[model samples]
Target: MDADFLLIRKMKQGEDKAFDLFVHKYYKEILTYCNYHCPNKEYAEDLTQETFVRFFAKLSDFHYRGKTKNYLYTISGNLCRDFYKKVKEIPVEAMELTEKTEPMEHQMTDVVNKLTLEWALKQLPDEFHEVLILYYFQELKLKEIADALKISLPLVKYRLKQARKQLERLLGEEEIYESGSKTCEL
Candidate 1:
């Protein structure tokens, strides 16, 4: 197991390898999460870099009271929040459609619906978005997500329910059509 505790210990002792290991483990996830939340790739990339920089600067102060991933994610989330505050004057509507769409398994008609769900996720309140992403994409259990987001399990369930309802409202019949139909293996 990649013990984040060990990594943090090495990091606190100023080991370069530990820092490299941390980046290797988290860079993709951090970038993906930030990109999903931010308006543009440039902003996402900047936030990702800033998150790591802040993480490194604060490594010595880390108390290891929780999973390193959760702690790191909390830091990343805070950086994203700060960025959002700075860019608050920019219209949210203007931020939409900045991401380029590529060919998906579903056609354009369905792509809009899929993107609608994703965009709605991005638009969700941070707590709901964090819980949903941690639970679904990260595949963490409710308890794990609650620990990660520092919320209670009941609150995690409630947020997940709200997120699902919102997503269903955005996806609607498209979800049924895609899921109810059988898939043929090539």
Candidate 2:
């Protein structure tokens, strides 16, 4: 049985400690997911909170129909939709994204490469970007990616193939099948 099943049982049985453990375990991961999708820190945090609030309300009704990760993403995705509905603002653009500071390297080239890659990732479509980030940045296996994204494994592969091609084309690279660690100048 999945850990979420245990967590669900504890939650249904009104175990406060188990609920705290569940939040501690998944809060960062869910936040990372929300940030990736929404990109606005305040909005993402709000969505994360809403997701858990809904999750708690629906906890006992939770079915193991999908992976727990995907369930969370589904909640997050819906919140993103609702957020846009309420705010009615222009979506965050990649060019507008500022890089979080890192240690200054001797060469500026690496920094540029990293920033360029981040921009490229932000520019990708949400579905493709989610799959790529989960697979590479989050270091999840393909199966895990399928679980997290709630897509079939074959669909995940197809999206990964398409995303890699798109990234390669956007980065103007002749080689299309490289790892995420490879620096793209664009």
Candidate 3:
């Protein structure tokens, strides 16, 4: 039997410890996903809580057809979409850049690259941005992302390809603006 199946079984039997274990296992990941969608930390926290709440509420109906974590992501993604509809905000939290001992000049370059990537991601449509976040930031497999987002596998591939192209264009534009010279070779 799958571990998640056992966990769900225990949870369904009203075992508080099982529920706690489930929450502890996935809370940080879900919160990180929500943070990518929502700029406000507080709101992201709320969305994370709500994702668990909805999952627990539907626990009885949830069959272990896929990974539990993916389901949580789906719930959080829906909640984030609803949040965007109400708030009309496009703010996104940037993924953390790697920390390493480097010279000041290299550090500054890393910061600029991070900012430029963040800006480019924000410029992408929600569909494209979500795929990039799931694939790159959250490190989800392509099939996992398709299952989580309830999208077709081919569609996911298409979106990822298009998103990369768009990001390249956006980042190229930023480089030109910053350096006052075209740096990207088309």
Candidate 4:
């Protein structure tokens, strides 16, 4: 069996160490997912913690049929949706620059493009935005995204295709696509 399965079993048996190990393994990933959905970092951290709390509450009932990581994502996604319902504001996050040997001009252009893309993504409907975030930002496979979102694989593909088209229109085909090439790996 996988480590997750073993951890879940130990957790069900009231092993605190197993729970700690499980949280340590997934906290960063879940926090990142929440950060993408929540505008405020503190609120995002709260959502991440709440996700873990809810998961732990439901642990006894949770069958180990699905990957624990996907289940955490599912919980976090739902929490994010609920959070937006109350706040109803989408804000762009500041881009962080890493040290690179590239020319300053190139770096500036990249930052501008990223900010523009983030703005365009915010303009998209939540359904489309979530799919793109899962597929690209979270780097989940299509199948994994479908599982986390509790949707069929075909529907995931459709959303991804439509999201790409919408982003292209919002960013302008030329700006988002470089000589018909995708800006980021597809």
Best by lDDT: 4
lDDT for predicted candidate 3 compared with the true structure: 0.82
Model 4 ranges off by over 4 Å: 90-115, 173-186
Superior by TM-score: candidate 1 or candidate 2: 1
lDDT of 2 by residue, 23-124 (tens): 888888789877655646777888998999999999878876647776877788778767757875545353234454754562355546655665777678
Q: Candidate 3 regions off by >4 Å?
A: 90-116, 173-186
How well does model 4 score by local distance difference test? Answer: 0.83
Candidates 1 and 4 compared: the better one by TM-score is: 4
- The backbone clash count of each candidate, in order, is 0, 0, 0, 0
Tens-digit lDDT string for candidate 4 (103-149): 99998887677567768888998889999888777878899999888
Decreasing TM-score order of the candidates: 4, 3, 1, 2
Write down the TM-score for model 3. Answer: 0.77
Q: Name the weakest run of 10 consecutive residues (lDDT summed) in model 4.
A: 177-186
Clashing pairs in 4: none
Whichever of 3 and 4 has more lDDT, that candidate is 4
Provide the lDDT at 22 for model 4: 94
Candidate 2, residue 83: the lDDT equals 74
Give the alpha carbon lDDT tens digit for every residue of 1-186 in model 1. Answer: 448878888899889999999899999888877765676767878888888998888777778764877776778788888887887655445454523465554455554654675576766777888776666555567887887788888999999888767766655543532321332111
What TM-score does structure 2 among the candidates reach?
Answer: 0.71
Per-model C-alpha lDDT, please? 0.72, 0.73, 0.82, 0.83
